[model samples]
Target: MKALPYDELRALYRNFLHSQNISKATINTAYVDTFYLWRKGSKELFWNAVTATDFENEAKNALIKALSENSTGNVSSLVNGYLSHLRRFRLFLASDGTAEPSVLNQGKTANRAYTRKKKMDVDVPYPSIEQVEFYLVKWDGLENYHLQEDALNKLFFELCPKNTDVIDILLKASTLNDFYSTNIFSIYPVAKHICALDIDTRLKAGDVTLVGDIQYVTIGDIEKNFYSFATKYCSHHNPLDYPIYDSYVDEVLRYFRNRDSFSDFQDGDLKDYVNFKGILIDFRAFYGLDKFNLKQIDQYVWQLGKDYFPKNYGKKNRGDK
Candidate 1:
């Protein structure tokens, strides 16, 4: 197999993304992150030299192990995004005879292993609204005395504003943190795009277009990038108007779904943002959570997820469990 130059292969990947109308920010981020993984796995390995065995080894040795240990499932996002792009890139290579079809079409064992690790179960019991209210009250009282807790409380309340200035500030500040810092450059465009969305229209139509600037920062995962930001923005603007749809929140929904709270609820339904939002609204109404805002509900559900899943919430990480 003739080794393809790493830089040239990456250029081809970028062009492919561009041809598909992928956002510039997303293409750049994917290129950088994917190349980083390639280098880490084997710096000298070329495009044609890249075998299914290499991918399997990388998933097993690096991706799966990291995801198994991390609590927030952040590593899973990065690894999964890389693997998805790799699969697509392989298809590209195979189409042009740059790489052997057999190598890319090997058995699905590696992909299955990655999926299993990514979907680890959380067995903790769900927290009732009463329990969450108790914690909220307790935290409210203690927040005045505890500087860290006070800061977090401020951020939470800050997120509730409908003003663009406030939203921009919060989203901008979010980029300063280690978790989202790497994508700081792309965050501005995302913030602008989100601010331009008509909250009233989305609420009435129940359909938030998950494309365009909303997709600015997201590389391969729509849930993490666009939906995550949109949920926060909408919940802040009007908590009752939108409920978050992250993995933690999904766990809470899954708990109810499994209990047959709504027989119509299918696992696949959660993928559609509009349907997911409706389900959350229904769940809120069903449980009589009118007294609490969706942000409060989000916080409660997130706490429940953390308690059950036991992820490491470092000291500096605020409000997010």
Candidate 2:
């Protein structure tokens, strides 16, 4: 049986450690690290191939491979510490409650487990086809998002691909502004400015200036920089080149940069579409995840951030997608 089916494994493991009076720190590590690999990193294809025969070595190897990018000096010790729980769980799986952890560690075991510092870093596993595919599944199953993609695609591509008139620009901008909860109160001015610029040519040319700052005329002549929304508009038009932006994307990138050092980019850099797309490119390359395109990458990264970093989502729907 695959390791993934054991949804209660974390609880069971935690209980076992507690019974042995294993340090709470160690128990917490068991919960968080396993979540990275088993919950987030476990692939059905990878785990299905795993069996009771040499399960420990196989599991260890898989963990190492998955963690190779960010493998640390103490990775071996950490993996063994992680495996302590898994080995018993595997036995319980094979023997069907005949060989539970309760039976094995009957006495008060030593509490000398090495405990990783709390939030020293997030325990996100390295990105792979499996993890990305998991988020892709979530994207497909996500509410209102896939539908929005279809409608946006039809409007931007089929109906009005070019921003030649104010109506075309207004409809596109307004729909996206509302769709994402971007909080653009004065949308018409932005649309007018975009319509004046040769937006189609700039988009086709991959102009970086399309991202930052907009000075448009009309009602009261206010200046606003709709960076994230601009990226989304461009991305909807050309997802291949212009990857979408939002706070969720920004958070995920920063988390990875801190966790894996995949790309060196400041938080403000994500506001620039060209820089953001480059950092994403760097991220894919660093993680050996070049198999997926920007569009696919965007879906998974956005979903992961939405799922994990849940602060201020309702108040600011910048990452609504």
Candidate 3:
């Protein structure tokens, strides 16, 4: 039987979240208020909201409003993260119908949760090896910069296999690292599962924020172990790139790559999401290998942005230091 009404449950969860000591400066007030209202108004709507078009539209509108105010470029990322939190909470509400609303509310949108897209998949214009080499030979040829699409297409084709596990590791690890760094521990396993997919299509069609600016390296704990081991053993260590995910990578991806998705992603959001295996496959083909095995190339190439570079001298966040 239900231990309490959904309203009380949500209140309890809110207290629980405070007890956990997560910061509120990072959250969207409107979104959280909406969930609280939803919990109090009608428990029946949570089920319909998950797959309902009306709810999606409402959520989208709320997101657009939130974005309009966040000129600092955090709107999309925050909205995507919050919507994901709402979706998962709704799902759990539908299941046992017993969780405290506060427990459900403990969610911080860290990653894209819209993995199971219903729409028919579309073809992505990935690039070819020959074309990539040709572009490299004459990179200055295209003044307009539409060449980025071709480069990414080529990267996608080369890196992602038709169906594989390496892609799983990248997406899972990248997002998981994002979450752990941001202190969003509840969604770590969910991030891990999102990486394993039947196709590269999952991330491309989702309704959530993209995973960007991730520092998948660190010093302690089982979660930090993978990046820690890799960073320590890898010969290409860059002491200056201690915080690893500086604006250089973000801008390169935004300007040259034209990938607004990653540009809009945040640590909290990326941590909660599952990525398109295909996207990771392609990412690995182009960027992952150098990052995974050799550190010098990744560090050097990413550090070219001299103007925006953060002083690499700060003490590492406990995880990465």
- lDDT of every model, 2 decimals: 0.50, 0.64, 0.35
lDDT of candidate 2 vs native? Answer: 0.64
Instruction: List, residue by residue over 11-48, the lDDT tens digit for candidate 2.
Output: 66556555543344445655665544555465552343
Q: lDDT tens string, model 3, 166-206?
A: 55345434432352243434433433433443333433333
Instruction: Score every model by TM-score.
Output: 0.43, 0.66, 0.26
The alpha-carbon lDDT assigned to residue 138 of candidate 3 equals 48
* CA deviation > 4 Å runs, candidate 2: 1-10, 14-121, 213-222, 313-321
Model 1, residue 222: displacement in angstroms? 12
lDDT for position 109 in model 2: 29
- Give the top-scoring candidate (lDDT): 2
Which residue ranges in model 3 land beyond 4 Å of their true spot?
1-9, 12-53, 70-73, 92-238, 242-321
Question: Comparing candidate 1 with candidate 3, which one achieves the higher TM-score?
Answer: 1
Worst 10 residues of 2 by lDDT: 108-117
Q: How much lDDT does candidate 3 score?
A: 0.35
lDDT of 1 by residue, 74-113 (tens): 3432344445455646566556534432343235443333
Instruction: Tell how far residue 13 is off in model 1, in angstroms.
Output: 59
